[model samples]
Target chain A: MMRLLKIVLLVCLFFGCDKKAERPSAFLQTQQIKLAPPRVLTTSTIIDSSIVLSADFKMEDVKLRYTFDGTDPTENALSYKNPIQITEAGTYSFKAFHPEWTPSETTTVKIYQKGMDTIAIQLRTKASIKYPGMGAKGLVDHKKASLSFTDAEWIGFDTIAKARIDFGKKVHLEKITMAYLVDTGSWIFPPENVIVYLNKTDSIRVQIPNLKSDTLALADVEIPIEKTVQYLTIHVQNLKELPEWHPGKGLKAWLFMDEWIFN
Target chain B: MSYNRRSFLKQSSLATLGLLSGPFYASAFSSNNNKDVIIGHNSHRYKVDLGWGMLDPSKTPVNDCHEMVQDSKGRIILLTNHIKNNVIVYDKSGKLLETWGTEYPGAHGLTLVKENGTDFLLISDFERNQIIKTTIEGRPVLTMDYPKETGLYTTKNSFRPTETAVSSNGDIYVADGYGEQHIIHYDGKGQLLNVFGGRGEGEEQFLNAHGICFDNRDVHNPSLLITARELNQLKRFTLDGKFIETINVPGALICRPVIHKSEIYFAVLRSKNSSDFDSGFVLIMNEKNEVVSCPGATAPAYQKGELQELYQTVRLFQHPHDVCIDDDENMYVAQWNSGQTYPIKLTRV
Candidate 1:
């Protein structure tokens, strides 16, 4: 009887230990590091249009490094903490390194000719980002691109109106030129019913007439400044409506301004 | 109840092998008697460019298409979730004709029905957790919220209705796919008729009751329902909610099935490891509950790793989300989350 009891006890012990082993323990070591926001650096001058870039996780104890040219980023290359100047007007790729993890990487920006003064812009909601000629394809990288300006800038309005630019500073009076980037044969979203105003009054607003490729170049509408105007207002009325041949059924609005030349 | 890990693996493996065997291949290639059966690889070549006329000239072409149906006038309508706009209409030649339904932020399932010579569209909104019907021109005709009459659902928008099936008499069967795991039925006028199945491992239950269709071929007692039980195999049921029998196409992750002229053709989303070029296959089932042929068949045994290299020609499927057979026995398939979300047509040669 005692031998039988011992066998039963051994089996019970085996099964009990097995159950305990199979149970997943809450003390399993786990570490989660939230990704850091993308780093962006730009020069105070518009001519030197290169922007330094890096991304580093603050929680992790790893050294971050980046490179500007097509070469690999080394210790001598710009560090994550320092601002790297982008002097050239070409596409530059950058890579950020962290030990024991996949490298957080980003593409180089395409620098355009400085046309106007930089006006800071922030999206109230998640705005649809896009390139001027390429529809919807280049919008995915909007978060990485810097739409904010750091210096005082002048913007001309056809009339006096309330204009709000994110992180923007108002400068002295200046003549303004408004040129719409139009891709003649290519398609664009939020089709041309935009009204430009100097002030909030509708009397100063001018309607942009629709022009096709055969009739006008994609850079079609250019409004020349006659007076030194301040407080520029752009009224994107009929923003909810899509183009006549709009292949998609949705609502999206965007403001694309290149250079705001300051006097 | 505890989920059975061992039994689940064993059943799943057996089902997979059973589906991948020669019998399933045979059924996929052959027509069940006189019924016309056409099968081909679900191609990922066509894409719907949603930026055809938008103001933002930077939109990418839509790539992931979930469901497809032909309209009364033979225009191919695609239900996609690649971008904000869910539904897109195209001509049979894969040209973008028109598009709409951006309001449904999460559109998943799309089925077209022509009643009284007017084309009607039924869509399953995944985010909204509702089923809606509209006209061909994108007008909201009727919207069916979660049936409050059915006391089974616990959450407010619990019914994530996916693919839908319509009977000759206009009865609608909605497979509550990503939600409460129930198949809800409604009359032609949108009255809640019945509800069956829930989240369970039992024979009659389902893990993800993805798609449903009405089998009206049998005249005497037309089977009221058929479903793609994602985990528990395929199931057929009576209109009164009685479980009849189970059909197993093991290892085959089936997305949807359609019956045309007494033959059953099922769309199998190519297994992740499969080297088949078509990312999916069509299985033809005979009355004896056996697979007669597998159209677009791959080799019985190619070195497993070698399949991926020959993926382009290997009768493989990417993610065949839905299938429909037209009156001319032409097979139409729509793949989800692919590089190109367009319908692939296969004519019975």
Candidate 2:
């Protein structure tokens, strides 16, 4: 009887152990790891060195730590907020860590000093006009009808009047276009007055003669050309200001322009 | 100015009709060698399907169908731009067999030649701005950078060579399409022979002179120069920097042209509207100097509310940037802005 009981006990124990092993446990443990380093933007050559580094993580409240020289990363390193800039020539190392997660790995990059890389600049033209009749508000305001340059140092434009623009420096101009949003029941007459200034210096103002308000029209213009100009001015001279135009009830204008090519 | 739809369509149709009946069309389609030629007026129809064979998984590494050349084994090897997946080898039936060239970035132009019983592939890399010669299996045999030793390129490393043409005696010509707008000639072993053309609007000048092919059909003086000027027209030139003639193709923005079986097929983008956006067309000109068949001709139309609704008509093309004709006369068109973004095959009816 005792031998049979012992055999049964051994079988029961074996089955019980197998069942326990098969059943999935409620509490699971995982070891998550990340291998990718932070993104680093460097110049084409190491000679003219400028590095921009950024680290982004999904974990909550993670802190990024970085060092300029080659060294072992520590927890008390300087934190990173925006993209870190490196102008000097040397090696850079970075790391990140979180309180509730594994420490982010380290990465290294090299930077070198170089000369001035040639930057190609392209200038585009944007010109438009707005008119408000007598006892009406003005058409487009001056501030909204301005042009924005990508590299302002390479080129500059001064608004001579509400309609004129002055160009500075010689640059290869590739394309010119205009964009405007007009109100309902408004129109623009003689759309051909949009001219470009060919020579350098002096403000070129746009003059709008015989202008009216309260009509709708498609004020988009595009001229395909490639030319070299040292100075350029956009003239919007034919606009007629109205006496009834006030600050709150004047013609509102909006213009947007882009895509310039200069070699 | 008020938008006049009826007048615009009438004027444009007349202009197109006038262009289709030009002198080049007269000579290109006529037969003089006792060969029977069938000329059809308005015989070519326009048809368009916005969603035809364009359905592939996004980011699928499909091989580019740049230029097609026949191999010794009667297979069609495609010289791809290598921008997506380079160097797709296809059969004559448009079947994708095997592909190579993920390593060569910006592979723009391709040409194939057989010399000494060995087949070689010539590739132009726009990013590297150099010409590379490789074996059929993608092994680099010779690589030529900007011919600085020839003192041709005024700008250093600015030669963005596009396509190539080879002569019977193994002279190679490279078209600098993107960079200098010049043609560089070389020997079989990649030695710089000479260079011509520059950035100008003159007779020998080129704006975006994209493609070149050897015209060997003329028996008397077989000139070896052809160019696809993107803005203006197609130009024929002598091998030695001489302008032979200019073929005017109005209302068509040409991209590339290739010759097959004594016929010339040029890819063109026709603006559907006066808005200057690209609708596509392909023109087939025979030796007699007439457009015997025009495939994928599209008309421009403005949509009621769509932002520039340029309708592609029957046989209408959507930016047919490059075209190739197989041995069976089936047309393969590579588009830049078609919804499919893959090469479309049009079987001849």
Q: Over the stretch B149-245, how does candidate 2's per-residue lDDT look in tens digits?
A: 7676665568888778887778888888877788888988888778887767777778777788778888677665455455446788887668887
Per-model clash counts, in order, read 62, 46
Best by lDDT: 2
Error of 1 at A156 (Å): 63
lDDT of 1 by residue, B63-137 (tens): 456777778887777777656556777665556677776777567778777799899998888678788899998
User: Which parts of model 2 are misplaced by more than 4 Å?
Assistant: A1-161, A164-263, B1-65, B79-84, B154-156, B270-273, B298-315
The 10-residue segment of model 2 chain A with minimum total lDDT is A134-143
lDDT of model 2 at position B139? 84
Docking tier of model 2: it is: incorrect
Q: Please, what is the TM-score per model?
A: 0.45, 0.50
Candidate 2 scores a chain A TM-score of 0.30
DockQ of each: 0.01, 0.01
* TM score of chain A per candidate: 0.32, 0.30
| Superposed Cα deviation of residue A83, candidate 2 (Å) | 62
